[model samples]
Target: MNSPTMHLPHDDHDCGWYGALPSPAPAKRLSGQQQADYAVIGAGFAGLAAARRLAEQKPGARIVLIDAQRVGYGASGRNSGFVIDLPHKMALEHPDPAHKQRLLGLNRAAIDQLQGLVQQHQIDCQWSHAGKYQGAVGPRGLAYLEHFERLMTELGEPFRSVEGDELANVIGTRHYSRAVYTPGCYLMQPAALVRGLADSLPKNVELLEQSPILGLKRDSKGQWLLQGSDGQVRTPSLLLGTSIFTQEFGYLRSRLLPVMTFASWTRPLSQAEMVAIGIQPDWGLTPADHAGTTVRMTQDNRLIIRNTYKHVPRYGKSVNEATREEIRAGHRKALLARYPQLAGVPFTHTWGGVYAISRNFTNFFGELETGVYATACDNGVGAAWGTISGALLADLAVGAESRHLQDIQAVTGMPSRNPPEPLLGLGVRTRIRMAAWNSRSEL
Candidate 1:
């Protein structure tokens, strides 16, 4: 391990997100004064990647990485584990065909980088080499996926285009009218990977768990000292990979909306159950019928289903019982709607986690005061992107520039001040209402 930073407060007592994944080893508590060249906040994918890269780049550079709770306790460990190469708003309204072409090119490269990292790290989180369905449940969804696939292939990526009953054969569902298959992506055990990455660190690096920085100060020497109730750490540079928790960095309380994305897992479906569901290919499923609802199967055979636009305070009574029921019902509807035969499966476990929502509903990054940087607003895709962001942001912290630095910087002007309580409340209510209206479930 590298140098250890102080710990923040503990998160609620939910560890099920790890989903029987092997537990990462415990990190030591912060004690006394520690000095480092780099201090990374939040030990999820972003922080971990930063820590590892810093170790590789500046060997023997004192680095202290801190987590508010245990590492991966946040969105990183709780993700649905979809390794996507697509950008947030990858299909922006940009009119320039060349810009669109270039974006497609970058997406291809991003996917390659993501897959390679999984392989290079020897991460054992059930890597599936098969293609996934970007199928549409209706005409519009199908058209969107088809257009996306067309552009991808046009940009030199591989995709299999299909429609009608043929689409059902590829996905395990009759719900979709059309679909395109791409072999490059996968369905993974997300929390397992997060834990694995944390455990694989060399002894030279130190991970401090349960360390939350309560405040900060600037020394006369121009360095920043992050202070916690238990201890204080002095580092000249720092990285904020806290996701929506970036509010801790200041001015992000409104800019980054913390949307809850809840997931439910059924008892591992028996062979009969799986067959009844028409899930032949084991490829991860995305709604070709629509753009939202992300559903997939874990390697262990459990169905992992999630829907977005849910929220509650960081810890507020399990999103209320009514909301929980809706998510659960929605998943069952998804299962039955897709595989009409598998209509009544029962869920064994139900839980939810938060996703950061920037104004554009994608990832955005920029400075939060001098010397402190925030790399958050992960929209919904936080697995590989969070890891890559952490790596690139670490480079930025060390004064090394990245080709992506400009594109992301352009989006993260100043963190928007959060709207008023009433307006923010209205936004949340609107999202819930819109989701309920579209879903097959009774709102």
Candidate 2:
């Protein structure tokens, strides 16, 4: 059987935020037989967190972490860095008071951990506690915001509702009729943050990049032998943090749905253009409509627009140049709809990132097969959810116990099974199209 691997499209590109940073030293590929006490596949947020926690717990044990690409080249880096501290859209749907509180606490814990790390290590990813705005474009979106306010009120979370001139003051865009300003989300340069985290991993953890795994099986001694393109690793314990590709491991195959989302970043805006745009220097806006576009004005004045979701069952193998161009055109239209003043503002980069969604919108977190543990399917809250889940998974691996771990396990018991293949694909595509249509104004 072919070893599961993550394949990034050759034509996919990153924004200037990533390209402007200095490259890390060249990757050291795995080329020979190696052994480790624990192994982590995928060096994104979750994998990095798992490796770090494991290394800290087992000071003398060898921990191997591998990624198909560079540390920050995947979804971890490609995301529009929003480290949310509250349960946003998905959590709002199933609002069991206790469960929501548990999730909120977990998310805040993740943010605290991340904040401490950034302060201690001085990981300069343009980290900011600038909060975020959930903007509404029409009556439907307004009703959604009203429901969000009710939930927030029940949870006693602080939020400010802004509209008309107040909304313009917050985002400088009159496109939104109203908005809810919540002060808990942190914004950052995603690629830089992931790179810093990877670089700061403990000494005992070995990081191998650009080495995709080809196969994985249990040896006669009950150890896992993971075969890579040019090498193999034998470990008694393994953690699968490989994002949407975790399906390839035969773990959450029936429950994991891979969705690819596109993002476009414009070139830095001139001082005059910034004035003309009439928005805050740096702001992040999530649409009140869950399916709507997400917008961010970077610290450096670049506009980041993310929208257009595709049901990419096989990651990007089926994503052609035409599809990419179509996505770009959609992004441009969305950008224009919100900020027509910045007409003709060219996007410097356009890229696609894969995120896993489950049938129940919960994560898959538990032991899959004997010594193999799987933790993924974050719905859409990748940054905070991935971090906390990884840390808790590490705690589980070492036989440690904590209330946080219990909360996570309780919340993400198991993913519900997905529909069979062709039907699953059809259903997901139809849902996405319908959602995009419903959120056209917000987009």
Candidate 3:
């Protein structure tokens, strides 16, 4: 087949968290011909982890890390910035008990990896171990939280339940009638963290940005050739932590679903507004209802509200103009519902990021071809999953063995196949709409 076309968003809507930070170092765009012992495509959390792990293992091996845009400009940077350790609702309900433990172990490992990097490098991305709140708005939401409490109890995890006046004191919003405070999630500025990860990569790894891979094929010399717009990379081994974009390469195409989640962050609150809202310091909260908004008060005092999921099907693509505006408008409404005191607080940034989810809610891992390996489809937990998966894929690439590697390899399988085109697309869109309606109160 000919080289596939790239459809990544041109705007990415202006991410507030990313925008407020200092500009990243100059990008090193790939040009001419380059060669490496290993090439890991996509420089998000996963790719960064994988590249770092490979560099550590191989010492002086030539490793090339490539991204179409700047290292953190994609979903990794655009996320709501929660490094969640607990299993999401779907993972909590996973049929296999062993699977649940394996998932939790991997997630915690990812968090540990990130924490260690931050401490060792003193990379200041406002990393906080303040945990998170899951707030419920009504009976359905309360029921969900109750189930969550039972799940945690079964797993022997500790959590604090708060409601009424206490919940309001914690989050500065009395909108939620009930909440479960889980202490394992860390909140940070995602863009800064990703940039730091790229900056701190081992000496053997070379980062190439603004270099979109058009195609990849095995050459006559038994090397994989990655054709990009301005250059090419040939490597003996490849790891694709490209997340949702893995579908474009004819890998995981049948089973992966590309969906975009939108977020908006208000400008830093004024002293008067802060006093009016009354939430002290910084905090983060996820919704008890699956479709509810994710809210965060930044270290800088800005409030970020993320809600609305849109199924766009194509990876690296942007939602349409109308859809983008609709999501942003919905964000405003969600914020107003919680903090009407902050009404008219102008949102400094609004953006959308794409994440891939498999039909069965499991991630794609392990080798796809003789020398090509992949890890993608993080479902909703991108930060932790991507990081750990990236590291594991690197180990897998070099024939390294560990319990982490074994746990990852044990779950290797293709994502369940999606129905043909329009049917699949329609189904995904319909499901999102239904979810939104069901979670309207939380939104």
Superposed by TM-score, candidate 3 places the C-alpha of residue 362 at a distance from the truth, in angstroms, of 1.3
Q: Write the per-residue lDDT of candidate 2 for residues 1-443, one digit (tens) a residue.
A: 23245444232555555675897899988889999999999898899999999999999999999998888888888888899988866786564888988999899999998998899899999899999999899998999899999888888899999888877865777888889999999999988998999889999999999998877888999999998879999999999888687877666767888888889989888988887766776789998888888999888888988998998866766688898889888989888888888787799888888889888887888888788887888888999998999988999998999999999987886779888978998998999999999888678
Order the numbered candidates by TM-score, best leading: 3, 2, 1
| Candidate 1, 169-253: lDDT as tens digits | 5455655665677776766677777767777764556788877777777899988888876888998887888877666455466
Give the lowest summed-lDDT range of ten residues in model 2.
Answer: 2-11
CA-lDDT, candidates in order: 0.65, 0.86, 0.87
Which stretches in model 2 have alpha-carbon errors above 4 Å? Answer: 1-11
Candidates' TM-scores? 0.85, 0.96, 0.97
Between the candidate structures 1 and 2, which one is better when assessed by lDDT? 2
Clashing pairs in 3: none
State the lDDT at 48 in candidate 1: 84
Q: Which stretches of candidate 1 lie over 4 Å from their true place?
A: 1-17, 88-92, 96-114, 146-158, 164-166, 275-277, 289-291, 313-318, 340-345, 402-418, 439-443
Q: What lDDT would candidate 1 get against the real structure?
A: 0.65
TM-score leader? 3
Winner on TM-score (2 vs 3): 3
